[model samples]
Target: MTAIGFVTRTTHGGFSGELNLLPICAHIDIVPNRDKSGDTSPDFRIFTQGVEVGSGRILSGESRGTDYVSLSLAAPGLGVRKLCANLGRTVGLNGDGSFFLIWNSVD
Candidate 1:
């Protein structure tokens, strides 16, 4: 897992970060998706400025059973396939800054 972004916890319980998705990078805000009423609904919504770009769901870690955000990110700026990633504790940061937005690799 490669961390492509850094996010800090917001006062409103959301996250504010800068995402670098190679061809397209932007300052992003991760906020709760208030319309989550079903199992498949996204747990959180992602935005750049005011435009929605993606969403995420809470996922359990495979090795440790810990929780993390599974992101399904997409926009016209991005390619046809969605950019899937994970949000978790940074290795060196130790959750101090919540330095994350790990890119999940297909290989």
Candidate 2:
């Protein structure tokens, strides 16, 4: 797993921070999707440079009841499958901020 971003909670129940993907470091915002109409709808929207790039679904750990954000980022350069990640608490991530966007790749 790789720590790709550092984010902190915002006063409006959102998150704002920097998404550092090597040479592309941009300030990003994880804002609540207030217009969501169904349970399957994304709970949050991710924006970078004022453009929507991804979405986040609220999730909970099965055993520990830990809160998490299941994120999906899609870009023309990222290919057919959207990049998926789990934004979880920073407790043991060895990173900054209250949450970390962790990328877990299966071999």
Candidate 3:
């Protein structure tokens, strides 16, 4: 049987900030909890290639009696100078979760 390995990362200092994540163009954020689900879906106002330039739910399941999930966004549409990406996520359910977003440029 193949064993699965888990990994967790922790960042510190000025290395963490919204600007560092989405420094240009897009306004990435978590779906506010106050807004009831099914009433409203996430809004990625910027659209490209006939696609919304965002990703769908990457995960969905229950953990520790709580629902765990995430969402993401793709790059290439933003027209950035470098080949980069923007990704966002929401954990738990009903938008009561936290967000992890990043705008990365790869050269």
Candidate 4:
């Protein structure tokens, strides 16, 4: 896997940064904010392969006592299949201020 861009958490323990998708020419922008109940807002924007795909605020969910956030993004008409196929294995941020979207083969 290769790192495409980097991200940093804000003072409020939320993500507020920019990440470049590299070679693909896409970018991700994250904005951190809280609601009246102190819930972190998932305000994010996604650009797929250099074109603006989708944008929205995701709601947080819990599973097995663990809280997590999930997001789904895709370009108009083209759908997520293409984006997912292109992104590959996993797309995640590292605690070390780096992010990567890799395509891994399970051999």
Candidate 5:
């Protein structure tokens, strides 16, 4: 089981409720080896709030041997506040591994 939580937020007294993120969490399993058939690359998609925000090739030599994918989201322009983010990843072709996180606001 994979769990994530903010020890504390810098801005407010009660920050947990605003994010919809639990103190602990778990994601689906990912396949160990996706190269069984020696295909070029695996297909992967990432969604936030049930909306497809990002998609790309998984381990297709972009970073080399990176079993994990990452993303960073921030307000479009500087000096703008009130923001939240959710990141998700699917490791391999078998659809056995997945992970996600909901980030608290910076405001």
Candidate 6:
């Protein structure tokens, strides 16, 4: 299994916030944008324990060289941070920072 690490921040009491280490399994599908002509546009479908939990697309960063993916969780009742942690554990991607993707590998 491969790991993909992401940084998560949770706000508390309307003033304080905590930064947490989050990771996700690499059993993901990078679906190319069919509407477009090339494979440059991709959408990520993230899975945990062989079940899909979230999907996201890469977004252009407000600043140069700062692109990020915006995830939309569909695992009912799970916050973004919790979902990240759970997905990481389920697919054995619990690491730090960002993870490398090994294509054509099975989890």
lDDT on C-alpha atoms for all candidate structures: 0.84, 0.82, 0.33, 0.39, 0.31, 0.36
Candidate 3, run of 10 with poorest lDDT: 1-10
lDDT of model number 5: 0.31
lDDT of 3 by residue, 1-95 (tens): 11111112223101111323334443333222333366245422323334444433323345545433233445665354432333333355224
lDDT by residue for model 6 (38-69), tens: 44443555455556555546666566766555
Give, for candidate 1, the lowest lDDT window spanning 10 residues: 90-99
Candidate 1 — number of clashing residue pairs? Answer: 0
Task: Write the residue-wise lDDT of candidate 2 on 1-107 in tens digits.
Answer: 79888888888888898777764677889999999999988999999888999999988889989788888887665567677778767886544458887875632
Prediction 2 global C-alpha lDDT: 0.82
Query: What TM-scores do the predictions have?
Result: 0.87, 0.82, 0.28, 0.35, 0.23, 0.36
Error of 1 at 62 (Å): 2.5
Query: Per-residue lDDT tens digits of candidate 5, residues 9-84?
Result: 1132111211223331312112222243445442333333443333323333255654433223322331344333
Model 2 TM: 0.82
Ranked candidates (lDDT, high to low): 1, 2, 4, 6, 3, 5
Between candidates 4 and 5, name the one with more favorable TM-score: 4
- State which candidate, 1 or 3, has the greater lDDT: 1
Please list the Cα RMSD from the true structure of every candidate, rounded to 1 decimal place: 1.9, 3.0, 11.7, 7.6, 13.8, 14.5
Q: Model 2 off-target regions past 4 Å?
A: 92-97
Consecutive 10-residue window with the lowest summed lDDT within model 6: 10-19
Best by TM-score: 1
Candidate 4 local distance difference test against the native: 0.39
